[model samples]
Target: MAEEVEARTLSRVAWRFIPFLILCYFVAYLDRVNVGFAKLTMDTDLGLSDTAFGFGAGVFFLAYFLFEVPSNIIMDKVGARRWIARIMLSWGIVSGSMAFIPEIASAIGLSAEHTFYLLRVLLGFAEAGFFPGIIFFLTLWFPASHRARIVGYFMAAIPLSSAIGSPVSAALLGLDGAWGFRGWRWLFIVEAFPSIVLGFVTFFYLTDRPADATWLDPQARAWLQRRLALEDRRREHVSPSSALASLADHRVLALSLVYFGAVACNYGISFWLPTIIKGFGLSIAMTGWVNAVPYVVGFFGMIWWGLRSDREGERTMHLAIALALAAIGVGGSAFLADPTTKMIALTIGAFGVFASLPIFWTLPTAFLAGSAVAPGIAAINSIGNLSGYFGPFVIGWIKDATGGFLWGLVTIAACAVVALAITLALGHDPHLERAPEAAE
Candidate 1:
């Protein structure tokens, strides 16, 4: 009876929540990273240099970094429904407007580069709290035993977007002569609409907590609430008394650096991989197909790895192993002059980098709770994502100065290794989550 109840409730919750959230994030990530696909033609259309484009792409993170913690804190105070709707609506407007930078620049008397930089930054601020907000929201519902796989499922949207959205983005690029606009213009406008529609959907469709989840059966809802409540009480025993103290917690600080390193490698690859593929003499359409390969493989790897971590009830070792794999794959690619070998190495690196992400969140979410967990999650994510700013900018600078991506690739790999070491040194607290027996 207990097993049946557990299975039924969890399955219902997963179906009720995960798929819709996945679609929302799918559109969110598509808007954010689609810039990579756009750059193929956008750079030429706007007369921008690689360095300038990198700065424009990466400047989004700076705004994201500045607003993330505050925005998340606000979400915690207000509710995910309102804040997320506002974020989506605003960013969709900004993202769609990206297609109009030239006209906007002419109207405002600013250079196109300056206009591009402003729009990217605004888009970042608009989208700031959404990711960490979702992660924190997951903790509110899922038990520690279930979290990694849940997060794995949610975070899978990242690569899945690239895998599926890349081809669509490529197709949009072919719309160059249609509607008196460039392909990148159509790409941004079409992609931006889903987010706006979804913002309204989020406002109406999402319920804030289990008590409010009217769609669930009464018995299943009660069971889920009990399980989640038990987990939260367990967490409160270790969580700091106030949310403010979490801002300075040593573990939070350490995790921030660890995330910084891993994210540095992840975004470095994401923002540049299209260009890297283009360098290999593939046509633009072919680059999209090739770029999707690593991510398609990555989609399966992320789920399997997260499940392994959950089943074993081990966070640190799993994270360390993934980060180490990332280091090896990405760095090793730097030395391979042969196109096939280099692609193979990068594919391996992408699998690892993508896999590490979902498992990494399980650690902090395991121990922190009540008022503190909100700020702790925000701080870690906001600080950690600063690496996003550095990663692309440095790669672009190195590519410009050295006339190659070799050193840039090496640098990103080294960051992943550092993240691995940090994970090992600050291994997870066993009692903070489910016991091994419970996992079994």
Candidate 2:
């Protein structure tokens, strides 16, 4: 039937963009979290104290928060092809420069710790625009009804990146004397170059919008454009002024709080998990290998939750459930005496944390539409990233003061509870009146 063929055709087009987005996010996540692996060795090699290392790690979020909204707005105006390519290339260069920090510091007669700090800050600035820009780009390509699952698929890159990066980082770290550089330094150098190549590839392969996609046949293009227009009309008209006005809405404020709480708990666990496991008496290589397990579990969890959300056309309940699971996991890990119990708790905790990500991203795009959607999503994301700064600092400070991870894990659990409270308060419905012109 012609109808069936059209359905299949649309499905192919819808999914075509996903793989590229996944690759982009995979590299971004790897670049962001690679520091975790680097820290295991770099701390001693660079003479950084626990506090100093935490500060350096936390500083990335400060830069990320500062530029997130501006970057999203720019992506809206300049389009994804140029902006994303620029972001990838710039950050790749900065990421690779991380390899030379020690040598540069020695050459300049600065302390290794100070140089490391400086490099981290620079890396943060370079990577500031990436995640939010990707979110903004997604709005341009996918319809609202379909955004959550696509976002989930794209977000799966997070765990997948971790899955691949864990073993790769372990191998790199073991390459201590390969080419006159420590394994940690080589990790930065080798991991960062791929993004640069991908950046150039993106410029050629990615189209900013359906209107700009020249590869589609005339019938296909016409069909897609019509669908998009109808979908847009389902939503209420958000004038440019009204788009900005959404910032003043009470719901937006509440959602921001929920986002902050969620991100705090997520980053807190991400930055500290390996260290916590190592504290349980595992060797560095063993810890790295073990780290992949949670990420693998998390990948499956994210897929299951994402598919469920798409099928049910729901968001809040799943997010609340995920947060509740995370709270229990963190709380149990903090209190349970058995090592096996703690590891089980951590695996469940990662599953919960990752599972919530797609839902968290879906809410903002669902609530805010049109020109306002980009800024609204960016604002939520920017505020949410502040948790990145707070989470790491809180965990590090608690660990330094308490001489263990218990208080820190408890603090993260408390944050998860706050996230749950906010989610319940926000309710489940998508608030925006769908623009009729939007693509279904």
Candidate 3:
């Protein structure tokens, strides 16, 4: 009866939250990266060089990195629903404003470069807390053992957004002349609308904690609350860290490097892959479909990888292996002459990079508990996301200098290798995952 009740509770929680959160993240991510699709025409239309566009695209992360930890800490104090609603609404407005950078530049007598950079920085600030806040919120509701798979389900939205959004964004590009708007402008304006709508829905729908989930029966709610509390006490008993200590912890620092390497490649690919596809001489719509193929593969890869880690009760080897795969795939892409082969190589890279993400979270939250959870997740994410700024900017510079993306792909691959080495050395403690009953 107890086992049955627990299963029912888990099922209810997953059903209640997972799909909605996926939708929320899907909207957020699509808005973030649709800029990739926009770059196809927007670059030429705005007279942007590769380096200039890269600077604008990458600048989002500079602002994001600066504000991330503080935003997350505020989320912890004010609660996830309010914080996330604020994030979605504000970013939606800023993202929509990206469509008007040229007109705004003309009116203010500012350079388009400065206008692009400014809006991106604002978008970054608005979206700062959404990702890690979701991660930390999951920690509040789910037990450690279930986190890898749960995170896998949620983070799969990353690829799904890219895959599905690719074609949709392309179609919006067809709206080029409607209302005297360019297709890329239409893309930004149309994509930005959903987030504002979803933000309002999120505020009303999200239950802040298990105790507040009145939709659940008393038995299921009580079981869930007890399970989460016990997990918290167990983790705090082992590694009890305050928020400040977590930021300074050596393990967290090391993990941040791994995350940094992973994101560098992730964002580098996201911001530039479409341009590389366009180089194949396909139309805008065809490029969107072609670019989506790898992310489709990656969607399954993340699910399989996360579940395997949970079943094995392992962390280190899984994270290390994932990084190695990404390093090899991305590094090898530079050497391939055939575009088809290059796409396949990038697909392999996508699998490893995306697969590594949810499983990576399992490591940090495994030991770090108490007040540390918020700032710790925030610190690690903030440091890692620094790559979001550097990766694209550097890649753009290299593309202009070398006349291609080969060496740039090679550079990002090296970052992946650095990550793999750290994960191999850090090692995982099975004790951190041991349930309190087992320890007792």
Candidate 4:
């Protein structure tokens, strides 16, 4: 009877929430990374060298780093529904405004490069809390035992964005001269539209907590509330007392380092993969389709690895293995000159890179609960995302200096190796995940 209730309640929650959240994140990630696609031509238009483009691209995260913790704490105070909606609306406006860099630069008497940097900064500030906020919000709805798989499903939007968004973005590039706007500009306008529309819909559609989830039948609601409460009670015994203290917790700092390595690998590839593929002598559209291949592999890897970790009730080893694979694949890609072999290596790296993400998140949520969750997750996300700046900047600088991507790939691989070491050393406690009823 308990098993049946668990199944029914979780299923309803998953169905009710995951799909729509995925859609929201899909558009969010597309808007964030679509600049990679735009860089194909925007570089030429703006007279940006590779290093300048990378620095401009990475500036987004600097703003994201500055604002993420406060934004998340604010979301916790105001409720995810209101704060998240506001975040979406603001970012959507900023993201679409990316289409007008030249005109905005002219009006403000700034160069286009500075305009690019300014817009990226705004986009980062607007989107600051969205990811960690979602992670914290999930802990409110689901138990730790179920989180790896649940987070896997939620974060699948990352790879899915690249998989599907790649082709669509590439195709949009075909509109180069349509209506007197560049195709990249059209891409920004069209993609930003969904986020704005969805921002309004999120308020009406999302319930803040199980206690407030009136969409469920009474029995399911009671079961969910009780189950979640039990988990929260168990967590109270382990978590830090306040959000501020969580920022200084040893585990939090360690996890931040682990996440930094992973983010380096993720953004390093995401920002540059299109450029790498284009160098293969393919046209813009073909480059988009090819870029989708690794991400498609990564999408499945993320889901499967998350499920496997949950079933095995292991976190550290699972994360370590995935990071090891990422290090090997990304490092190997550096030495290969053939596009086919190089792509094979990158695809394997993509699987490892993405698979590690959901599993890595389980470590923090395993122990953090109540007030600690919001700031802890936010701090880790903010610090970790600093790599979003360094990774792309280093890669672009390397490409400029060496006239190739070899050393850039090697640098990301080294970052992954560092992450793997950290994960193995942390050593998670599976006991923290048990429900109060189960423990008793």
- Compare the candidates by TM-score and give the number of the best one: 4
Better of 1 and 4 by TM-score: 4
Relative to the true structure, candidate 1 reaches a TM of 0.97
Model 3 C-alpha lDDT per residue in residues 350-381, reported as the tens digit of each score: 99999999889998889888899999999889
**lDDT value, residue 159 of candidate 3:** 94
Candidate 3 backbone collisions, by pair? none
Stretch of 10 with least lDDT, candidate 4: 431-440
Sorted by lDDT (best first), the order is 4, 3, 1, 2
Ranked by lDDT, the better of candidates 3 and 4 is 4
Residue pairs clashing in model 4 are none
TM-score of each: 0.97, 0.93, 0.98, 0.98
Candidate 2, lDDT over the whole model: 0.79
Error of 4 at 234 (Å): 1.7
Pick by TM-score: 1 or 2, better one: 1
Winner on lDDT between 1 and 4 is 4
Q: Which runs in model 4 stand beyond 4 Å of their true positions?
A: none
Q: Which scores higher on lDDT, 2 or 3?
A: 3
